[model samples]
Target: MSTMLQWPASRPARPGDPLVDSFGRVHSDLRVSLTDRCSLRCTYCMPEQGNLWLERSTLLDAAEIEAIARVAALDGVDTFRLTGGEPLLRRDLAEIVRRLAALTVGGRPVEVSMTTNGIGLAGRIDELAAAGLSRVNISLDTVRADRFAELTKRDRLADVLDGIRAAAASGLRPLKLNTVAMRGVNDDELHDLVDLAVEHGAELRFIEQMPLDAGHTWDRSTMLTRDEILETLSARWRLTEVDGRGDSPAERFHLDGGPHTVGVIAAVTAPFCGACNRLRLTADGQVRNCLFARDELDLRRVLRSELSGTERDAALDSVLRASVLGKQAGHGIDDPEFLQPGRGMNAIGG
Candidate 1:
């Protein structure tokens, strides 16, 4: 598909006019992919080899990322999450965090967070926290060392565990663990994963695997649903649904009693399209309104154009507004005619 090209000559978007889509859902969260290179080759996330990687010259630099983020913040985006195939792969990651930390929206400081595999996080958690990283969501599917090696094609389970401890010690509050439950894979270890979370004082969330895998062979029959997860957990612990979840994707529950909680993201079974409030910027600078969106607006072109600073910022604002205006009602994963996106989860910045 061709990128959106029309640009408005107006000034930057006003704070009064938030980034709202056609469905009237105002977006305040922006997810930015720093790079597409990763250390681990997870079976579910990518192929074992022959994976295509973006050239460093094509990616948005730290300055460009900060500029785009500033534009988004000026439009009332209050939350920014850095993501990637593995964000730590970027050498300038700490610098990026420090730059984004200086951003604010509507007189409030912007919240900066990251979604990482936690392989290289242990040694840098202190530096990252000092750079203004507020929280981290680590992706860990199984607790068994053998299972971890089999699933990710890496023997970094010990590294990840140490990273979790380092994160806690570094004062990354409300640490979160994300697990993708696949039937007959790691589904049998749900309780064990929860126990690990409780032990570390981190909230664990089970996510229904979507069709974003590199294999493109995701079958609904083999997938585990949210109801089944709750059924299994309820057998072991008393789970009380927490009220007022707001726009967050996770449906939270208290474990046994107060002070400990778990969450489930039923993206396929229980869609939260009406309340969806997020926009994504690919590392190569394409703007995506939905994870399954086939269309993209090329903001990188604007950033690289010969336009003046004012003109470039104005063009970026126009592209951002147009992208949000074109947001779809839902990802359409449950629709009979649904098709998986061409890009894998790693490329799309999960």
Candidate 2:
């Protein structure tokens, strides 16, 4: 089967417009994968040794990323989320962030944020913040060092904690911490994880584990549900629903005993496909309309081809538009015929 996704032959015609799908979903948020290389081997993300690393030559460079991002910005993409196997692994991240931050939309600078594992973020928080990184989301599954090692195959809990603190100190307040909700693993630490976030004025986000594991060993029965997570957190503290979620994935709540809020992504049980305004660009330059999408459009070919400058822009515009046009109404996780994606979360940019 061909990997390239074909543009709909029967869909309505609207060429060279904003990134809006047939469902009237306007994509204003762009998720860019800086690299597919990660430091840790999380149980829910990938196996100890599963997916191979993407070639450095294939991964988009700073200028390449900026060029594609510029195209999106012109098309009304106001915010860019830098994702990865671990985004900080890219040594030129600050420069990339600076370039992205410089992009203007409606006379305002386009937002640039990142989702990382926080392994190497401590010392660079200040530098990144200075270079136009608006905010950050760091993944910390467990607060216990032993459990962290068990979950992520790393004993870098101390380093992650330090990065969290440094991010807060650098004024990245409402610092978001991403926690993948596994059934038996780390489920017992909801309160402790929330406490860890509250202590540093961070938002603890509980993401229901999806079927994006590299090992493809995810059992639906073993996954934690959204209700189960709320039941546990509500038992510890009173949770008042925060208003105005908009298109944000995490459904937030105010912890009565704390100054900050907590969130739950609930990707599986409570999929937010309707309000999803996200588009993903893979490390190798394939644009995915959805994370679970079976197909993607290749932008690398159009990027490196012998098209003229104007022709290149037109080609990129078509690719970006087609990506959004192929949006699925929902991820269809509940449908009996639904199959897990071949690419894992690491390769899909989280």
User: lDDT tens digits, residues 67-88, model 2?
Assistant: 8988888888888999998899
Q: In TM-score terms, which candidate is top?
A: 1
Q: Which pairs clash in the backbone of model 2?
A: none
* lDDT of every predicted structure (CA atoms): 0.87, 0.87
Instruction: Give candidate 1's TM-score.
Output: 0.95
**Which stretch of 10 consecutive residues in model 2 shows the poorest summed lDDT?**
1-10
Q: Once all C-alphas are superposed, what RMSD does model 1 give against the true structure?
A: 4.3
Off by over 4 Å in 1: 1-16
Writing each residue's lDDT as its tens digit, candidate 1 over 234-325 gives: 99999999988778889999999868999999998887777788899999999999888888899999998998687788889899999998
**Superposed Cα deviation of residue 172, candidate 1 (Å):** 1.1
